[model samples]
Target: MATRIDLTLDCADARPLAAFWKTALGYVDEPPPAPFATREEWAAHFDPPEDDPDAADPAGGGAWLCDPDGVGPRLSILRVPEPKRAKNRLHMDIRVPGHGGPAERWERIGAESRRLVAAGGRVVTEFEGHHVVMADPEGNEFCVAAAPA
Candidate 1:
């Protein structure tokens, strides 16, 4: 059987990172688990005397995002005390698929890159005729590729 996997990112703050990723990946905030109708409902019961040790999140302790169509793996952001000190060894490349012709492909890539920039990501460098490297708000590096065949 194929193994299913979830992606976890360690960061300084999870909420904004999760928000940025949600928009970047076209994902939605993952719904709360059973016994809780919504995330807010779950948060409401935080750290009471009888609270379940396994079920507590203090405000923005963490965040989860998932593909709306349930096709992609779950992404969880975990807040850590330390900041990112160096470049990422494993980074994600955002694939912006090409549509029709060469012109159309480049156009689409440019549009997506621009959109990401407006969403708080900044362009780092461009690989001619290929991809553009970008940094998330927290300075994590990732690429916006020219899509896959």
Candidate 2:
């Protein structure tokens, strides 16, 4: 059997970036941990005292998203102190299946690219064979590729 895997992204801010990914990938926020009914309640658990920076940002920490139908791997985005200074060593390639032919596949890829751009992702560049390199709002690079037949 194939091993199941989860994905992680390191970024400066987790919430907004995770939100962007959520929209881009049609994923939903993973529910708050057990014993907490909602995200607000979970966040309230870490509410900082007065005069604390955490009071503004909250210490609840990070963001996780998962495929709603449980078909795809989970995605975890964690907060990091430093900015990304170089290209990613590993990156995701968003795969859009080829529907009928090369033309249809390219069209679908274009449509999805536009949707991602509308959701605060930018197409950094395009490449051969229906591939478009894109960057999230935080400038993390990934690609949207037309899946092979």
Candidate 3:
């Protein structure tokens, strides 16, 4: 069997970051485990200590997202006390779907970039006819590139 993996991001806040990623990646909030009606219900089962630094926020804690098509790894955004201090060693490359000439591919990349910008992402740099380096609302870097041909 193939090994499955989940991608995790540590952030000062998870809800807004997760919201931005959902729009950027076309992902949805992962449903609670079976038999649990909601995420809160599942969390209540743990009853973590109030002093536990890793505990989920009672106001609506960490956010989990999954690709709607079930093709991508699950995303787990956990809350952390410290802020991000440096660039990410690894980042996501969001490929725009298309098999076309440079001009057409650039157009597709530009469109996707614009959509992500509307979803709270900002362009860091653009390599015309190639890709655009972008940062999410929380300043995590990602790229918008043309799908491989």
Candidate 4:
């Protein structure tokens, strides 16, 4: 049977990435920390209970951020001690808005790819169907696909 989808981002800071993605994907923050009356109040509200299954970034790596408004999958930013080693065995293929198919699209990808590379990402390659391969700052691969109709 087919199941739902979840997106995981391996990054250094969960909040920043989550926030950036929230803006990028137009999603609200996962959830405010329970929204107490005051920041102090919320900060003060700590539970010393056991079996609540809370253990301080237990992923030891990343945190899960969600978008209830989005039809897309939930996103988790994991923090790993070691870094990504090689080319991704799996990659994300995203579609963006391009004027032309291959030539013009390749030009746009070239410009966008430059920006991504400048932002610490690399352009792994390009393909026929108006697609480009990109990686995030942490070297995890994703794509900037031509926007759909």
Which structure among the candidates has the greatest TM-score? 3
lDDT leaderboard ranking? 3, 2, 1, 4
lDDT of 4 by residue, 3-122 (tens): 889877766665555555554455654543556543334434665246533335333434556667667777767654456677777766654566666666667656766665665666
**Steric overlap count per candidate:** 0, 0, 0, 13
Query: Listing every candidate in turn, what is its Cα RMSD in Å to the true structure after a full C-alpha superposition?
Result: 3.8, 3.0, 1.9, 5.5
The lDDT, on a scale of 0 to 1, for candidate 3 is: 0.89
Candidate 1 accuracy as lDDT: 0.82
Model 3, residue 44: C-alpha shift (Å) = 1.7
Residue 141: error of model 1 in Å?
1.4
Q: What is the lDDT of residue 5 in candidate 4?
A: 93
Angstrom error of the Cα, residue 77, model 4: value is 0.7
lDDT (10s digit) by residue, model 1, range 1-149: 89888988988878888888988999999999889988767767665445434335544467888999998899988777688999999899888775577767777777888999999899999875678899988999999877666
How does each model score on lDDT?
0.82, 0.84, 0.89, 0.60
Per-residue lDDT value at 135 in model 3: 94
Q: Judged by lDDT, which candidate is best?
A: 3
Candidate that beats the other on TM-score, 1 or 4, i.e. the better one: 1
Model 1 residue-pair collision total: 0
lDDT of 3 by residue, 24-141 (tens): 8899999988999888788778868788766655524589899999999999998877888999999999999869899999999999999999999999999988999999988999
